[model samples]
Structure formats: structure tokens, C-alpha cells
Target: MDDDHDDFVGCDTWDEMTAWLGESLPDIPAGVTIDFGPKDLHIGDEPLDDEFDDTDPIEALCAQIVVLKHGRYLVRRSHVVMEATNYLDHDASSATPNLWFDDDPTGDCTAGSIYVDDAGLAAEICVTWLRAESGLPDPTEFGFDISEATHLPGLPGTDAGWSLDDFLRRLGH
Candidate 1:
């Protein structure tokens, strides 16, 4: 993994995540406060999809923010991992952070693992994943950029040298 902590300097905390969502997305319906601390966020009266039926309930929450490099624009999404605790142990936990590119003509989705010392670090880790997945125009040319972005203090080593662009290229993108 990259092991560089510099990229995660400014990230939202649990509370800030809630506030940021309120300020960004349209107001959630009544009784749907941006709280994912206790009960999991359910879609409706229906049970979760069968694919997610075996998923572990979330013990923590994180926020997803999408930023466009060339424009002063950003959008936020808060997602609760229903299987976070399965990867957690006494001193740490792992989260699978996913990025949905709604605007990508090719319908690309990016994701990776993030380790957290505690639940409080979830948002920061999520932000790190976002930066790595944004595909921004930077010195590292997206490929080398993401290849050097993974950094979790207490988790197992990740395939940081892995590059999304290369994967896409191999897949004929």
C-alpha cells in the first residue's frame, strides 16, 4: 500500500458527515435523520435484498464525496456498510469503500479496502478512497496516483501498486 498519510489531511468526522450531507443532498424525508450510529439505514418495510441478507450489520458509517477537478463542484453520499464488523477485530476494523460513477459513460465503479483504528476513522478512510478513485488530472496520471494512495494505519498491506487505469485498459476501455 502507499502508506502516505498526507492525502487524508482534511476529512469529515462522523458528526461533520451528517452536517455535510444535510447541506449537500436534498433534505431526507421525515424520520430519516442522517444518523447511522445505531440502527442500520433501511430502505423500507421490505427486508433487505437476498444478496445482502447475509451481510453483517454496520457498526460504523462513512460519507462519500464526489469532486470535479476542473470545476468548483462537489456532491456527497453517505453509505453505511452492512458488513463492516466482519473484518474488525479487537484493535481495528476494515471497510470496503465503494465509489459509484453515475456520470461515467462506461458505468465504472471503483472500490477498495480501508482500515480504521476505530469507528471514528471511517469517514477519513472513505475520503481517502474517494480521492484515489476520482481519476483526477494530477502528477501521477490517475494510474500512478491511485497506485500510491492507499494508506491504512493498522490494516494488512493492500495492492497499492495496482492501477485502475491499467485494469480498465486491459479490459478494453
Candidate 2:
């Protein structure tokens, strides 16, 4: 197993984040759908009607996660989807939908949110969340045993095993 901490962290802008995702994730297929709500804000599905009107911040954030995960990607891609919504009026945030790979308790993964005013802050928040949710030895630690998680097969950019198509397909049309 590679102990390299080569995992990219800390992005200063949405563009940078996207670029990072592109590099990190394997190639997405043509039929695959990435539903980012709105023309300019193409990250997730349609925003909730009362998202802006809602007083609570967490509620709005949760709503956005639903829309963002609509997009699909390969498992080995390691790509995460992010969206910008008017719900919080913040610069940016992130959300994950599926948390676990299998029935194994140790295989648990999380689909949550990280809100911040800037990319730098957002990256920090993501690291913190990863540390807290995974219960790893350290927050900075990467590459843990994901044997419980389903194995992803295939090459980058192609619709191979565990591709975005596979993920969305599992969700059902």
C-alpha cells in the first residue's frame, strides 16, 4: 500500500477545486449526467423553493447536497462534487451523498457539507470533516482500509467498472 500523502488539499477557488477534481477523478463518460442547478451555477439539481427563505443554515445545506450528488462518477476516481447555492449566500460549500461502501461498519463513508467564505477555508473545513467522520488516527492521515467499500474497475475517462455511470445507474433513472 502506498503511504504517500500525495492527496491534493486546499483549493483557493471553485475553479481550482474543479481542476483538482478533474485531475483526481477518472474520466467521466458521455452518457453520464452531472446535474449542477442553474446555468452559471452548474453543480447540483434544482434548489429548494424555500432555501433562501429558510432561517436555519443546516437545513438549507442538506437540501443542496441532494442536488449535487445527482451527478455520477467512478469509485476509484476519488472525485467529489460541489455546488454553489443561494441558500446560504456563502461563496462555496461541498456535500457527499453515499457514506458507506458495504454493510461493514468500518466501511462507513460520509456525505456531508463544508461551508466557508473562501476556498482556502473550505479546504480546511473538508480536512476537519474527514478527520472527524473517519475516526482515523489523525485528521491529516489519508489512505485507510476501504476493503469494505466496493471495488472500482476500469481506466480513466472511459465508462469502466464503478464509473460515474455505474454510480448513477445504481441510483436508478
Candidate 3:
């Protein structure tokens, strides 16, 4: 409420974090599809809860979300902390693209998730995160632009705006 970073209460657990994000962000635009984290558990070095047996199937935190927009893919990843959302070029002819898992040296190998293709939705998601984190009700009031949002390795031209054409032109297609 104070607009201070220290005053903002970040999530302490994965469930809290993901659920907060899901509720805080706007619904994905029509034609957009999103995939959450894998059903399998990737607890890494963390100790398993006493309530479950070693054979029990634990659900992994919904940390990796992939949104496919305009045939391209944008990955929203969260490690110990949430990271900048990222994008990948459209490659396969299939409806769903294969998600690759990076083997963490520390051993947290959780696969990413997905959403349907739509650049505006992607940008909106980024802006929403920025607003939530910064405690800004109206992003523009603070002069926040999509460019200043959490889009990692960002889309090409700042002129194209948050559209399919922007991604296409940036990719040089």
C-alpha cells in the first residue's frame, strides 16, 4: 500500500505465488491458450513433507508458464524468484510446441507451460506483473510502458507496439 518495495509482501511458497499471479493477471485473450507447470514434482533439494510417502506423486509448483502468441512462444519462468518472461520464435507446424527442460546444476528440472498465440496478451501479462510488483494501479501514471515491463530479451522494435505484427517484424519474417 505504501508503494515501497520492502513493504510489499512477496509470496513465501510456490502455491501462494502462482495462485496470486493467476488471480492478479487478466484472463488470456480469446484464441490464447496457456499451459501451467507439469504435474510431476521437482522438489530439488527441498525435503519432502512428512505427510507424503516417497512414492506419492507430488505436484510441482506452477512456476513455468508458456504463452504462445502469433505462432511464437513466450515463457514466464520462476526459480527461487520470478524472472523476466521470455519469448521463442515459432518453429514447428504443430499446434503445440515442445517445451525443453534445462537441467539445473542444483537439480530442479521442471518443464515449462503454455498459452495460445497472441502478442497483446503476452504484453498485458508482462504489464500486469509490473503493476502488481510496483504497486502501481495505473502503470502509465508512473510513465511505465510495455518496454519497461518484464519482457526479457524483448521483442524487436519499440515502434511495433504489442501486436502480432510487432513480433513478426522483429523476427524479420
Candidate 4:
């Protein structure tokens, strides 16, 4: 994992976070669909009226990512879709606490969220969520785990994993 902790935290955009996830995780099975958008942005095949425009100056931003697992298995096969989320609490003052991932998108499972500005941590939270929805109870299956109440620190972007620089390069930054 990269020892330069500062460099691996807090991603500023969805593109960057998506790039990091693509580079970090193992090859997903074909036909897997990963839908990422603002929280409460979509419902039942229709987009909500208050969709995020990205230009609107907001106090807080919540990004929801849902992965539809077809017929895969960690311990057993699951037919239901799973969702995870990350939030950037720009409105968080010394007194106001940040928002978290608690909504049950599928109306069945309510996964946790990571309240950090780090992109790596956000990606890690998604990974953890996927695992939890994978029917596997073991957290060590992935290498590390984050506390449910204290959502801090995340999966280490190993030496073999792609870095933010890689995403920047793709963007010609």
C-alpha cells in the first residue's frame, strides 16, 4: 500500500473515483452493471425531479453507487441488487455532523457509508458494501475493514494498484 496517506484520500470528482475503482478491484464478471449517481437521484427507472446538476453549489454532496449482482457468489448466490454510498460533507461545521449511508435502496438491506473526503476511502466503502451484500460475513476477505460507527481510513491502494496519477494521465491532466 502507498505510504503517502495524504495522496490517497479525498477524491474531488466521480470520474476520479470511478477510475480508481476500475483499477483497484479484480475483474468483475461480464454483464455486471455499476450505476453511480447522486443520492435520491433515481427511482424505479425514472430520475428524480431534483437530480444533481454538479454546477449547483450545495452544502453537502452524496454519491450513491449501486452494483447489480446477477448470479455471483462469495459464499452463496444472491439475486438482489446491492447499493453503497459516499458523502462529502461540505456543510459540516464544528457542531453539525456529516451525513451517512443509511437508506435501503433495495428496501431490504441498509449498508453503511464512509463520511470522508478521500476518494480511496469512498471506493473502499463501496468494496465493503459489495462484500456485505455478497453473502460473506468475513471482513478480512478483502485485506482490511472499516468500523461501522467510525468510518475512517480504508483499503490501502497497494503498490500494484493504480494511483490517482493514472487517472490524471487518462484525463491528460
TM-score of each: 0.21, 0.22, 0.26, 0.26
- List the lowest-lDDT window of 10 residues for candidate 1: 139-148
lDDT of each: 0.28, 0.28, 0.35, 0.32
Native-to-model Cα distance after best TM-score fit, residue 6 in candidate 3, in Å: 22
- Write down the worst ten-residue block by lDDT for model 4: 141-150
> Model 3, residue 122: displacement in angstroms?
1.2
lDDT of 1 by residue, 6-41 (tens): 121122243443333233322211111111221233
Ten-residue region with minimum lDDT total, candidate 2:
59-68
TM-score of 4: 0.26
Off by over 4 Å in 4: 1-19, 22-109, 135-173
Q: Give the higher-TM-score candidate: 2 or 4.
A: 4
lDDT of 4 by residue, 40-115 (tens): 2232333324674534332211223322123121111122323322323322223212245354343323333323
How does candidate 2 fare on TM-score? 0.22
Q: Under the 3 Å rule for N, CA and C atoms, how many clashes does model 3 have?
A: 9
Model 2 lDDT tens row, 55-106:
4222111111111122332121111222221222111124332332323121
Error of 2 at 129 (Å): 1.0
Poorly placed runs, candidate 2 (over 4 Å): 1-110, 139-173
In model 4, the number of clashes is 5
